[model samples]
Target: MVWRALRPAFALWIWLAIGLAPLAAQPATEDTEDLLQKAMKAAVARVAPSVVQIETSGGSDILGSGPGMFRKGAGPTTGLVVAADGYVISSAFNFANKPSAIFIAVPGHKERHVAKVVSTDNTRMLTLLKIDAKGLPVPVAAPKKEFRVGQWSMALGRAWAGLDTPPSVTAGIVSALGRIWGKAIQTDAKVSPLNYGGPLVDLQGRVMGVLVPASPRGQDETAGVEWYDSGIGFAIPLEDINAVLPRLKEGQDLKKGLLGIYLKSTDIYSVAPEIASVGIDSAAAKAGIKAGDIIIELNGQAIVRQAQILHILGEKYEGDTVTVKVQRGKEELTFANVRLTGTLSAFIHAYFGVLPVRDDPELGEEIRYVFPKSPAEASGLKPGDRIMKVGLAGSPMQPFSGRDELTQLLDALQPGTELTLEIMRKGAKKPETVKVRLGVMSDEVPEDSLPEPATLKKALAPRKVAPRQGPPIQPGQPGPRPGRPQPGAPRAEEKKEQPKDEKKKAATGLLKRMTPARDHEYWLFVPEDYDPNIAHALLIWLHPAGKNKDKDTEAVLAAWEDLCSENHVIILCPRAESNAGWLGSEVDFVQQVARDVLAEYTIDRQRVIAHGLGIGGQMAYYLAFNARDLVRGAAPIGAALSNQPKDNAANQRLSFFIITGAKDPLAPAIQEGKAKLAEHKFPVVYRELAGSPQYLDAGTLQEMVRWLDSLDRQ
Candidate 1:
């Protein structure tokens, strides 16, 4: 038996020996580590001198005052000098609100000069600053359309790695590419909080990205701890910067293209379809496109993936034309010569003394209604009309479609010029063509001009209003009259109590309701025995961290009922977006809600108060500091404040009722906050809970309620 087994094993061993002999002879490749280091050093040496140290002196707020006074100095912020005259591109997160002084450190020079904030592209999270220095070398501008993955990249900045030193340099490779707006290039470089606004350079000494937030793990490594680099720092792609830089430098207003529709992807292999619509007056509606339309092509090329649409459109310039093909059901159709429309960015850029069109999702086909006496309007263009072609003075007529071409055209045009506009309006059989003269400056305004009462009112006007559907009428409260129709409501039921005179008038004009009022306003809650003629105090209560849900509302309402019964104040608990909680669009939405409430109701502005729990408290702090003019006082519980510094005046005007848990780690920070606030003369009332500081449960509910109530009563 042993001999038989050995015979089989010998045969197998011989086969293995033959395979192993060939594998062992394979040769190895040379190491590329040296090449990588050389390339990195070359890239750094080239772009480092072009990088500047940004020092911002921001105003610190004590309480909610007015605009706080500002001071200046350099901490550690990184910026890329993109122009020969020393224009640096930095992140806007570093410059919140308008501050007094922004200075950039010139390479090899001890002098620092004040830099002017040229423009801020909020959507892109980037800002451009101009320093008066001359003869500075600007990095080679990158093309805005493409960037490949696995590209070699370097980062240079004054990194605040520790309190002991100034900014320094860090190197890494591009880990990935094709990031969305508000995101950065993912690189292996070590980016710290101090590296914010720094430039990412490539081997050719050109800026490839802007250094932004990196992985947070490596900070403790300085203590000899073993933390590793995340290799995931992001940069603002040089392409987006290149596309918008001309407008930023020329102080020209940019015009971004507007596509009147919203889109979502479907499983259809051959085409992309519109799953739903967001608004009616959007650019899509103006083009006569509807929900459920299947899109097959753009500019005569078939579109396979949905991801390419936004990029393709976002790149176009205002006034450019595009051709789109769609299939509605089994019917194939094409819409050609669609003109790109300018949006909010155009106006925002105009104000920064930069000229660039902003792409606003809010500005649909109705954009014609808002254009500021510009060439397009002078040429007889109307809102909801689609432009098909644009004819420049000395060039052939070109199709003005797609966001990129549109934005470029708006940036490329001279102040005074004549241009032809080809337009098509819904309900029209043939396209109407007209000519308009371009103006030197497009109608762009500054951010300060945004809060104008008229503008706010116009922006908030209700697009439609109708009587609300409600439960059956009770005895005392107003409900549908037994025999008469309610105002603004259709007559589905006949009434027996209709007066003879009321009946006669209803017979004549009941078919029509008074022109829907200019605005439709709804009150979330009204106090019992409320009167329209009597002025009332309005309390805008922001929900606590988790009170944004149905259960949360019930609990809040129960507590509010107890307070409102005695205070007789109108309580408005405006619903917040579930995803953004309080930080999302909450501020803007709240501002609008407040304005809407004031316009529709007799609100005592002087008595208006803002109060919040956790997330709500954060919001209260935000408004108290940013929109002090709109609020009277604030109360925040178990909520932390934003790290961004606030102004002294806005802080002063604010009166805070702060509540926190005794064991809360943030309590010490809150005490330190109180001392800082004391410097601004802001009044504060603080309460410390003994146990878990998370929220206002039953034990602490009364104190929280009473504290908020006292603000109005006092």
Candidate 2:
């Protein structure tokens, strides 16, 4: 039996060797080609009996929108029979719409069997189905050790109708091994919805893996569906699936194991596995892991870079035990049998009750505004009080230099945790220590007007100019006007000389007809006195359908001019190609424009926001969720949430500022959306205007600006 199993593998190797041999030493061209063709056909015939056709009836038209969206077709999908007693496996994406009924047709079987989903492996995005049938043909699984990059492989699917119809076959070579963080094999063969749950077989007809859509970045069921027929395809190795088949058979849905530790750097390739913060009540925290420890090994695998740790843990499922080793100050610690969990407590951003003044950290983190009924308020902490140091109670206080450092400290703690702060008042000689308990972030807007930020305050301050001492100008020559340009003056002919580099200097003030690329146009408004030294916030404005005309652009600029300058923000309004409305496909164009602006200007990454109304507001939600790496906040005025919001994460923090009128038609939906975000533990600020209106009022606009400015608050 062993030799029978090994014979095909040896023949495959010999065939491959001949195919790759030098031209002079190769076999006859026609004979070799004929043999390859015959082998491919035989392989497909061997696996065709195990392939099944699945048809789902009654489901939603499409799942949400944007990059992660999934659309179900009205045709049948493919599945693989994994057991003799009617156990089958298919991609979870085929049933993402929660179909009302599922029917599976086996080859040579005249009747179709009704099937029900037994369980799912969320980590690999695979689903197992059970049908009341017997003696199903189970395909043989190829050994993992036999898989080689460049080996000939064929993908077979039974998506086509009719019991006598042959399975569809696509032949290619294995592109890679241990891909998708060691969970899948990469293939050059075309894979799509048609063959998602079909078998990828070797030249000998043994099953190599099960085809599935997967992405390294996203874990949703339909995450990597966008890469269909793109030469880059993924298949989970059969051996890996078999190892967890017993658990899945027991009706226990599997989830990706989470360590619940945020790293210090987002660059996983070059950075060491250094912990920045551990989620409260997380598996890592329960295992006694703390912040600042550098992980050196996990599950017996040496972890040098952060990516290595991810790869090691990517294949792990909930309830699995892993051993972790980390290096502290001068000692190495090893934690054994640390069981992983599927879910961690949703991260609630702890509130310290004070907004730090931007760009004014010379003495320490100087407070710009203190929230009412907050920890700082209860402790008598006021604006202009610089925090010198902060730490947990009974711990050594660590001095911080700026708001960023203070934020890091606060992020490592949870709500209800007691803290000690060393505060230096505006006119105090000595610092005073205050004790306060942290609380959950508030959603209410401050009723009182907020003090100006540092930049605006400096801009508004009166300047003292020295007496002019230049050579006396002739009567006809332009006089030296101190801090002023005389009107109707010659102005030295206002040199229009271009820089030698020919790179167009970024223009300030309202800029119209700005085209980032061919067939794409947007209007940008940069503060007239924009400074590269001072980081500015970015607000991407999506105008309502049919409201992206020149007049509308001008009205937006007119309304936001003073606010942008005062708040150090830049306004970007992208015009849709069609005046009717925005399309889901346009998200890429909008994202590209936002990237161009971020690259060209010194934008504060933490304060980047997406704002819009009506249809535009829906697009804003799409961009914010799809482009989580770029946008930190979203303000959807008079727009209801169209797509479900992702769970909040400590590293990729996202906040929402939702505004709707009391009598607006979307008020109820908007309120429900706000509740959803809050339930996900995302910080949300919701406001309801007095009357029905298509746009924000002056007071609401100002309040929205305040919300944007405070996004960086810890």
Candidate 3:
């Protein structure tokens, strides 16, 4: 189907090639390869005037690091002319260092011209640059829809220089189309840091796409950079670039458009696109879409699976309107003019200040304890009152949908907002609707909180559990030791198949060490009696500066073994570089390691914790703020807040446990951090220890584990 559409464009390219060079139908020879090289050179020469080399000055080396993909050079990057009036578009990576000055060396221009960032398209990871020059050459954009796999593609970039040559160019075929969720065209041409902002041109020099580092699985700018020069490359379609060029001309940075709906299922491949939760103030909710609605179609495209939705919406930017069709019950509802946004109004989880008991004695949601002076208590509500329904004041009542729904509605509301709660008192014949004003949560830790209840003991006293070991090698398997077969080896046909999860599972033990990269190392501890079927909490420890000491490994194993066994907990200790101190840049390295562990282990999504002591705790705060999707709980002990926490991810709730010693000098900073987080409506449990030591004691560790255990509480 695509080839049929591309026939005209392909035909035009063939005729243009013939006109450019006198060609004859001849037998294939060594000079045929030379003819291909000449064609590539001509294609590059036509676009050479628009290709510019960019250089930066006076910025830290921090921007040199990228997530997922490692980059080799930080010296310079490439750019392309998007307009004749000096508006050039380059990869956002070029200016990521926040350089003090930028200069561009344009083709045919002897001197470099000063350039400044005009706007950024974060959704596509491109930055538009403006210079004082005028009448710059702009290349023609090839029709993206007419692209075909195996089509001749040429990658051009000015990353390096030859004495008399234009930009460096590599030739290959279009490896794939509609890659990066329909955002980019994939080419096997070796793409690297040097040619990132250059053009992927056709045989006739029409721009097909702007070369960039991108991954289908990752949306960030640095995502696919490691594959540079590795026969896998990506480029943002030039047609899409032209469509958003006007917005970039106006200096408005573009961000990925968001619908603000959390899907019900984690398995995107097979699960239908059903909303698990919808932001109360989001476009989906405003359009009258509910949580149970299954997203059946988007922008007229059928959306059968969750991945389909991601692919369709992957490149959409703010202000884009999309038609959404959802199935509610038997009715298919189409919502037109559903506008998307890059940002949402800050959502603060308004608190009612009630701690429900562990178990319910009534049919409805029961409150075990109400905080003193809380909205729940002020509204004349008491312990043992069953909350049967909740709704806005003067509205019809709706059934209470458990703590999660209640929490979501509360989070969607601002402070001091008034709402109604239907409470059924014990032995009461009827329920009463009480008006309650939403309030802020207290940061005060419980004065007398008990260690996680004895359910952990029951879990520890288990009947049976799987032994923590790597997958068993099949009979006759060569395994890591090549050539030598195992005893009683069965041939391939006779071997029993192992479950997919077991086959690729990670190693487990008290201290199983893994090095993800050259300088990256992490240790994971899985209890000997680990149960693969049961979800386990993951506690990632970030030790204080230089605290990745010789003794730290043994100490961690000794300290957490009992707690891990008592409760289903997996401990991960990621080694920081030198422990000299944590840098803000370490966030990527640490996040990468955590992601690896999460992928390999059966981690409880709700109970992931980032616990760091001292300066390490500071880094933990940074990690949690940025890693809102993964780290549900953050425990920063004896450390100041180095960076402010970001607002929660859409529909995500983050809780924190801040610990400080009474006599510690950093106690004041800890207190300040707790107060600030509370102001933002985040749930914070402030724990003050008795001693001045910058570490938690045994009892404190016990309390910490209990807190970690309860993180999954509804």
Top candidate on lDDT is: 2
Candidate 3, position 477, lDDT:
12
lDDT of 3: 0.69
**What residue runs in model 2 are displaced by over 4 Å at the alpha carbon?**
1-28, 66-70, 361-363, 456-506, 512-522, 543-555, 574-596, 614-619, 638-644, 660-670, 688-694
- What is the lDDT ranking, best to worst? 2, 3, 1
Task: List model 2 lDDT by residue over 48-74, tens digit each.
Answer: 789999999998868644323456778
- The C-alpha lDDT values of all candidates are 0.50, 0.77, 0.69
The candidate with the higher TM-score, 1 or 3, is: 3
User: How well does candidate 1 score on lDDT at residue 472?
Assistant: 13
Best by TM-score: 2
Encode model 3's per-residue lDDT on 369-435: one tens digit a residue.
5667788888998777778766566654555333433454453455676778789897899998899
* Model 2 accuracy (lDDT, Cα): 0.77
Per-residue error for 236 in candidate 2, Å, reads 1.7
Q: Model 1, residue 342: displacement in angstroms?
A: 5.0
Candidate no. 3 TM-score: 0.71
Displacement of the residue 139 alpha carbon in candidate 3, Å: 1.8
